[model samples]
Target: MSQGKSLEHLKIVLTDIELATENFAEKYCIGSGGYGKVYKAQLEHFDSSNWSSKEGVNKYDLPKRRSTVAIKHIFNPEGKEGFITEIETLSSCKHDNIISLLGFCDEGPDHMILIYELASRGSLENYFESDDKMTYLTWVQRIKICLDIAHGLKYIHTNTDQDKQKIIHRDIKSANILLGDNWEAKIADFGLSKIHPADQEASTLNTHTIAGTNVYLDPEYKKYGRLNKKSDIYSFGVVLFEILTGRLAYDRIYTKVNKKGIAPIARHHFENGTLIEIIDHKIKEEAYGHVFALSKGPNKDSLDIFSEIAYRCLVETQAQRPTIDDVIHKLKKALQAQEKSQKENFKMSLEDIKSATQNFSDDNIVGRGSFGNVYKGVASHANGHTIIAAKRLDRRLFGHGETEYFRELDIPLKYKHENVIRLVGYCDDEIEKIILHEFASRGRLDGYLSDASLTWVMRLKICIDIASGLNFLHATDVNQEVVIHRDIKSSNILLFDDWKAKIAGFGLSLVCPVNKDIDYVIDDAAGTIGYSDPLYSKTHFLTKESDIFSLGAVLFDILCGKQSSIKLDDEHVFLPFLAKNRYQVGKLDELVFEGIKEQVDLQSFVTYARIAYQCLHHKRERRPKAGEVVIQLKRALEFKVS
Candidate 1:
């Protein structure tokens, strides 16, 4: 058969039209979706040398070597020719992170094919969803994937010289992201993409399209039919949540409640920092502080970088979120911080960790929390590991006690989350719940907030991690209800080995909707003094924002540190007018020690302190939600990260 007639006689688009050419080879099949099947093809063009380089090629390898292309032959009888045009325009708008288009064949109306550069590793969906596949992506690589998507979006939305018009990649999902062999991410499948005029500030298309994978859809766009940069950001945020947690956008178990499955769970993780709990079990161990320390850090710089970038990208509000350009800048800064810190803190092998913990000396007791006590156990498990934390939970809380105490002890089990302290195992046979978690030898936020040992960047990072944990909690669903972590204070927020804060002490956590009032009776007032939400304490209704208020108190504590609740005349040297009655008035700043006060940025410091002030408002309604607090904090700390 002639080459031209052979291609025509294939009858590829129609089911009934038998191919005069060879049947579609099984090996060439890339993917099959509802619309049609995608076949891998080779199109020889400009540099045939790029094709002929493979002299040891057979028929099978012929197509593989000749400028690899993916041909999507549509079998949808209703598929319109406009689909081809849309694909053509999309193919023209090239991006370094976007799949390149060799060409497309639109010979006849019914038989249309869209071609794209082949990605050997296939779709991101396969990596995330397949049970036997690799789920363990290093935190650094995850950050890079985030940057790749951000760069692609920036390219599309900013309409750089290559793109004549600003493009909206309306469908930004893991499935649409293709992984190259080099692990570079390429944004693909722009079937639902829309082009907006460069001159227009905001324009809407796809009035009838209303398309997106359920898990990654932007709530704002889904509800309002709006599409913009924010929509893309929201979608990317969902993707980020998925990457961090290793959870699919949707899963069968969640389908009972709604078809749009994992969004609620994703939102929950985003708010509570329980994200690590939901991470793929295969990769859960890798998500902890120790693994992070061993692989990505010795200096704790990468934790700061990851926390800042991930936290910023997942901001609930689109307006408050950073643009892709801003995201790239922050990511680059994080990378640099990681590089700089590596020089200061050498990577510790697991053997080091084993040796450090083997001694288990009392002198190694570094810090402790409400649920457990931490010892600076040498990293006994492996070499090159640094001082590890052995968190032995109080067994008394679980054994031979009143049923209520046992129940209370079980609460922490429910919080088996990364940010909250990892529960390695227990020494229950000897005592109560002797849980071992990674130790943060660097001390709690309390130590650094007041010590002057932490830099402004360090303090900001601590606060961001705390916020992330809270955000995850407030957003997660527990007992089919959201959890309101009534206690969010400095002491309750523990610092990890890397000095990143993780929220702990869930004993005070109340399942949401059951007890909204903050003022309700507690065994002891649910939170630390001065940090409790005055409104919640009085009203007993603690909303999600109440936690925000408590976080605000922590922010204030971060700013003022030991100065948070000092009495004026206790010889503790309180700020002037800091006495109980006069302190709430004005002139409080004048009382601050000149030495401590000069180093702080009154504007920025006040902004943070004021957020705490609002959180402590006499009214619960006034306190911002955890999401809002996250946004505010990100904005306040933007300069530091930048």
Candidate 2:
């Protein structure tokens, strides 16, 4: 074999490989990102005979499996270290909750490709912005996503082989968390990850690199450029806040005159019981639990658990914060306790309820939420005439936590309330867990407002009823627990045949902290779209004021019969004008709900409108409490209605 003969043979092989690569790239390309292009590919299963006794490598197989893999081909002509590092880190890590790396390809100096199991559902970030994606993941599915991420982080921090180097995922934003076909979360993007030497136990690793999303990055890490496991903790805190509140970590800023407040401001408000103010409107409605009676007022136990866990995990000083293992332990224990309590509190079976509701006929459905479908049914214990609302948890949907639901509802059911919806009981067997509540026959206030048959007086009466119930929830003593509705939206305000309103849903709700976080709450966001408080959405702050803002939005929605955010239909080009005016301005009444001009008294309506406006005030300090809203509404009712 002469040198020229060897060269000739190599050239022939290279030509064939190049042709195969080109075909793969062209046929399978799906999407492109910063590092490379992703393609959904189908490769033939490699047999020993195929590799050893092949006349030539076969490109196609006789039979194909109904499976696909995502191929990320990195086109780095210069052979970049950063690109190589990302691929290497991801390839080395192996966790059930992290996307699996099937293989890698070093086709040429200019091209490096990594193969991973395809995520049919795509990134979690898609769900927030794309209407299609939002429709796909329901509230229950979102909670599972959060749990998956937590499990993945716990594995990275503690469950790995002790002899091996510990892993730290530097980037843990929503965009980096991918969803599989079943909506299971898979933490992706390990480009900035580091392998901590097994022996070293420093809070800050002396890494000469700084990497993470701008808003999600921990303040200490940003200031000192120090890398550690706690950095991932801080990032996860922001992710949790985002999930609970359904808002970006830093969409809006809260400042005092000239001083710039820190990002994740919800952390500051966590201890102060004001963290609820920062939750996303969508999450507020969805995660918003039912109101329960306590010695002082209404209470939301589930949200209290969420806020405590999230706050501890996101403590400003890494030394004080719980490790991922600690966080998981606490959450698992709390969840288990809740599940056990729910099992003990209930007596009736799903079959009995199904039979009572005539096999869950469509006519029986009385209410609905982001996670579960609701049905109206009768119970045998309360004589045949007593009607109860059965909320059936939809397991198929993505976005909410069923475990949290059971945990939050048990205690509330044991204690009855006059103004709050009475939880008669709940049923959790194998297929589903459903809550049975005393039915509010008139349905939600949202429907009342939407129905033209309801006059201005009816709407006003509904408004007063909501304020009174909220007032009961907020008014408390020094020794009594303070109840925060957490979610105060039009839909949650249910009405009876006589139009008397009762506040429902206390699962995502929480009891107020005696000593609340002054700046922010670190829990995952939970609420509805259009009605969420902007302050709570950005910072995960769950203040009573936050509820006031949401309540105000609901009031505004009812009065206007339109969305709160004013839109200029004719001026489709208000970007320049809006930019100049700080995106504020444009008369509230004129811009929104233009249809309500002659239908309602403008004077009486204006007073309620003003109350709603004050609730939505951006500053947490400026917004009135729920009690205050009730008082003011009472005053308005006396003046306008009388």
Candidate 3:
């Protein structure tokens, strides 16, 4: 193909650019700097495959779809390098966290422009600069934004898609990062980027030039000129501290005192254990703001992990800095830790609980478990009036004793996730103990197992949700103890109006703080009869695998569209036994629920069945972890019909 035919979709003429920007009017220019003015306009977006080639691809054949685009108009001779570098760099890179380069205009030396998808919220630098914008960003959102940048950087560093070019963005700063309408982060500005041979190692690059914002520049790259991916990592570490401190790299305070910026100051504070002193007051509010409201803040563990990694990234030696991959992993772990403890957990008055549930009336009872009865009630909250489930502990009944009641209440308060039930303040006053939970409008997951309306995809999603909850439960805390929900069952899984599932009933859970190396605890056999692990029951030992066994039984119940056990010919036949026998005989399809049998894809069925069967493995050591179950169930859901 000739030059005219090469990526014609990405070749916007100078006249079209001029017309869109109203001949480069002043008002249309959203920003201008050392590079050039950036103008926002509604321009035609040319789809890669869309064309009227019969018309020979003229200006008249431009695609009809209009979109908001940011056109970077470069006229300065000094800005030409960045314009060319950005064009080459963005064209080869493709990722969700990277800004999209849509079209470009290079008619002559004086007329050059590059168009990009408009980031509505503009560059991330704006957030930290304005107190009003900073207020909108919570600590949780900040962590996510950092994770997004780390993911994009990883893509650039690894180049696993066979691009055959090791691209490095030397200018890694908040100003170069753009934020979308929903605060989705995208890396931008590749003006000073370099393309090295893909086969070369990270430290192979030896350059005499030092470029990038001064405060965010790496000391190793500046002095020794050892430019590589680690240089980018150091700069990113500076940006990370900037986010944590809510201060710009070039803040007057830093420029006035340290000259090298917050990097050295952050390192000193982190080493001396006074890092929290420099933390942004606004974020400190979010981190410790657990007094009221459903909107919660960051967990201490998450902040510790995040701050430690950020501090590590800014180490003086290039070798001490972590790779982009390590940064991504640590960021994900921090997000999970924060999300687990991010919720409104408080205490409620007995009078308010009584008012919500009509003095614990029998008519108010919506669910009855071995522990007590759950009553649906309406309560006033800071946001507005909300419906809740007030689980009233019946002291008269031989159910979960005081110890178990406290344990059940503590779990939801401390560990919060979408898949795990949210606690809404508890009531404990002189034998009147009750736990409030977010009400499940659609009732229990067991009720809809056989319903044809509950499609296979929905069932698969519910399975994933419950498994995720179980996985979250198994995370070892400070005590190095794992939580084993010994009473996992279909009935224990509550389904919301939207068919979302959450694990409930933690009264029988065991927070076993055994030796770190031990996986099981020697305890009295305990759990629901049909769903209990046979190994635990026989040997008087409980393990996380016991919960896995129970989860397997629940999976089979959902598959077979019935309870854990069925009475056949005057004998109780367990679903696990029937499933195993049928599975071994190569007839597991016979066990699929009739309502969803036709809807289930063969691959999906096989994947789901294989994992569920693995969970039912008689040998405790053979059982798959809850995380593996989550992964397989998601894969099964993916294969389901769209």
lDDT measured at residue 172 in model 1 versus the true structure, 0 to 100: 90
Residues 364-419 of candidate 1: C-alpha lDDT, one tens digit per residue: 66665555455666443354443445554545545533333332334444333446
Q: Which stretches of candidate 3 lie over 4 Å from their true place?
A: 1-345, 396-400, 476-481, 512-515
Q: Rate the local accuracy (lDDT) of all candidates.
A: 0.57, 0.61, 0.81
In terms of lDDT, the poorest run of 10 residues in model 1 is: 1-10
* Cα misplacement distance, residue 54 of candidate 2 (Å): 21
Q: Which prediction has the highest lDDT against the true structure? A: 3
Ranking by lDDT: 3, 2, 1
Residue 53 displacement in candidate 3 (angstroms): 57
Query: Deviation in angstroms for 129 in model 1?
Result: 1.5
Task: Tell me, by TM-score, which candidate is best.
Answer: 3
Q: How do all models score by TM-score?
A: 0.46, 0.47, 0.58
Instruction: Score candidate 1 by TM-score against the native.
Output: 0.46
TM-score of 2: 0.47
lDDT of 2: 0.61
